[model samples]
Target: LGRIQIKKTDGTLILNSLNASDSNASIKGLEFDKSLIKYQMYYSGNAECNDKGYVYLFFPDPNNLNQMKLTFMQEPDIIVSCPSGYKTL
Candidate 1:
């Protein structure tokens, strides 16, 4: 599992890795809105095999009730690698 912390004042992002085996974790890009108090982060490197993808973290303005809704734009793709004749479900 992973943990993310955002500083409200300056939109600073903090990523915490709980597992000892995790490495090379980082944030690739970030978009922050000071006025709306919202942010989107593109991150990668949480997997053991150096998988590439985006981990988006969104924070909406607390005052706006409608903006508080969460939405999933798309389903994540899962990839696995193994020796020949090995089956994965």
Candidate 2:
């Protein structure tokens, strides 16, 4: 029941409102992996999908990682990504 939501400017990656806990769901275009230890959300086109991809990893942020919003890039020109380990309300 998730949907593609926003598109970032920098990487032109698609951002989506995906449920990380949904084992049957796909973030960006990859299968949802509950064991992926997602500390941060990633939006990239290079992630398995030819156009969109989402990855969850610990991004290096000065402030609290949870306090920040999703990050994006404008190059790959083809995919969508989202965060994991937490439900988007």
Candidate 3:
């Protein structure tokens, strides 16, 4: 892996590669609110935001990734903003 490349999708790159395979990758933390609703079809996972005429999501680097259950699951790349705004569609 000796090339700088980009993986564009849904406004965010699910996986970014470094020039070298050993290079480190940074994935931010994700927080889900109890009031937030989850709309899988819209990739919206915040009930609070959903009820507030908005939606949000984050690709958090779960501190305990090992504890995560990933069984052929594909997560969303674009983390919604918040009870920030409503989706047109």
Which candidate leads the pack in TM-score? Answer: 1
- Per-residue CA lDDT of candidate 2, range 1-89, in tens? 23445556676645555544454334343343475434433343234334333444443455665653443333354334544343221
Pairs that clash in candidate 1: none
**Which has the higher lDDT value, candidate number 1 or candidate number 2?**
1
Q: What C-alpha lDDT do the candidate models reach, one value each?
A: 0.43, 0.41, 0.32
Question: Residue 69: error of model 3 in Å?
Answer: 19
TM-scores of all predicted structures: 0.30, 0.25, 0.18
Candidate 2, which segments miss by more than 4 Å at Cα?
A: 1-4, 8-24, 28-49, 52-54, 68-89
Query: Model 1 residue 11 lDDT?
Result: 69
* Tens digit of per-residue lDDT, candidate 3, span 1-89: 12223345565653334433434322222445565432121222233333212224423345644443211123434535554455321
Q: Rank the candidates by lDDT, best first.
A: 1, 2, 3
| TM-score of candidate 1 versus the correct structure, residues matched by position | 0.30
Per-residue lDDT tens digits for candidate 1, residues 20-58, read: 343443444456557545454444543333333444445
Q: Which ten residues in a row have the lowest lDDT in candidate 2?
A: 40-49
